[model samples]
Target: MTFEFEDRKHENTQLPNNLSAPNPGHTHQLISIMNTQKRDRFELLSAYLDGEVTATERRQVEEWLDKDVETQRLYSRLLNLRSNFQSLPVPSAQPVEQTIGQVFGKIDKRRRHRSVAWGGAAIAAMVVAALSSVVPGRQVWQMANVNNSAASEPLYVALNTPVVEIPDTVLAPAHKSAPAQPAKLHQQNN
Candidate 1:
């Protein structure tokens, strides 16, 4: 049975003409190769549209576009896309001087705010120091008065002393060597 099957297979393999039939595997391989080449051409055309291709590359892409209608269509689509982008409006650029001035102005404003904050802190510290000194001094004075009645009494006597009125003739000479005239004193009671 194996010998008969081999004989039939050999007979079926022979064709009437010298031409060979196309293999399905080979056809699939060729299709894949063509697809790869088309992809490469599309990439080349994209680069040409972007102005990234060299002169030699430009000529190659042009030649490919001329040879293949599909490549030519792709190139036209990319050109249209580029033109659309170029037609869009763009914002105007600011002058360098104006931009720098604005940046400096913001920096100066921030610095002023920081300085004001520091000034407020300094004022608060000064108030605290003044209060601290005055409170301690008053406490010490009160303590001294409580400990010594004689010392405290003298302080009151000095404050309540009567004002004495002296005549202008007593202060007439500006020079120390000049003779001084004696002036009568009048005491005013408080």
Candidate 2:
């Protein structure tokens, strides 16, 4: 059951001691307090139903149930629900030892399958590695045995720039005490 702000506000309209109506800000505080009270009351009732409540709390719940028709109906429904749950069949459980043995058996079976799968993968990898190395080695060997007649032709490289010899002194590194002079070279520019 829920109490809306409007319903609480209506209840406040009939306050004793000629109390004034709550201001807009105070209205929110009242609503929160009402919600908290309702939640606490329900928790107390649950504790009462579970036989976990102290005598005082039990009395409080009884009084609350007596005064509040909604609470009474709620308590009745909770009682019926609890009874239905208690009346349901309880499922039997297997022995703990047997259950544990089954779990370990399954784990061992999976481990065997995983080991076989990993072994097959390792063998496949070795085969692939052997094939890769053998193919490359054979190709290299075949290349080495090819005719050398094509390789006997003299190899030469040509450049467009004319070669000019500079004296070794001009190319030599100068002492740090005397600053180095740049080399002057003759060139034909295209």
Candidate 3:
């Protein structure tokens, strides 16, 4: 099979209606130039709106706006935007005391939450420490009485253990107990 490559440069040269297509390079350059001019014009108009332009510059912008319908519409929109911004309600100043109180309240709330979390963590650590120190297969009371003497040993009563009563003679102290009494003072006469 034979293949042929068509020339794109001459494609737009000959048209049925004899109309010439614009050059791609010229079209792009024209567009860029127009955009630059439009940007400069808008800047001038903005400066005019802000009352920063001289009398001559203001006149030039006025003339350009009067001649171009698009520019006039753009300027009208800019004016409307400015007026809308100006008409917006200005926020009133809040009382300094109330603002300070609100700020402190927020700070205090955060501090309280942090303190509560820290307290919980401390309690958890203590519980872990206590459990780790206890010997395996031993009651928590036994751990408490580890340092106590045999005579004053802790009670080993279970949950289901029956209560037993001892006679008064066994319950009494082994040694003689002294009765507590108030002392009387005797006055001496000279």
Each model's backbone clash number: 0, 0, 0
Tell me the alpha-carbon RMSD of every candidate. 25.9, 14.5, 25.9
Any runs in candidate 2 off by more than 4 Å, and if so which? Answer: 1-24, 53-59, 130-190
For model 1, the local distance difference test gives 0.69
How high is the lDDT of residue 189 in model 1? 28
**lDDT digits (tens) for residues 11-87 of candidate 1:** 43323232335877666666665675566667667777777776667777788777978888888888899899999
- The residue-by-residue lDDT of candidate 3 on 1-190, one tens digit each, is 0011122212332232322357776666666656756666677777779987766677777887889998898899899999999999999999999999999999999999999999999999999988877759764544344544775966787567447755668656768766544342222221
What is the per-residue lDDT of model 2 for residues 82-129, given as tens digits with 9 covering 90 to 100?
Answer: 999999999999899999999999999999999999999999999998
lDDT of 2 at 72: 94
Return the TM-score for candidate 1, rounded to 2 decimals.
0.35
Q: Scored by CA lDDT, what does every candidate get?
A: 0.69, 0.71, 0.71
- Residue 84, candidate 2: Cα error in Å is 3.6
List candidate 3 segments past 4 Å from native.
1-32, 127-190
Could you give me the TM-score of model 3 versus the true structure?
Answer: 0.51
CA RMSD (A), model 1: 25.9
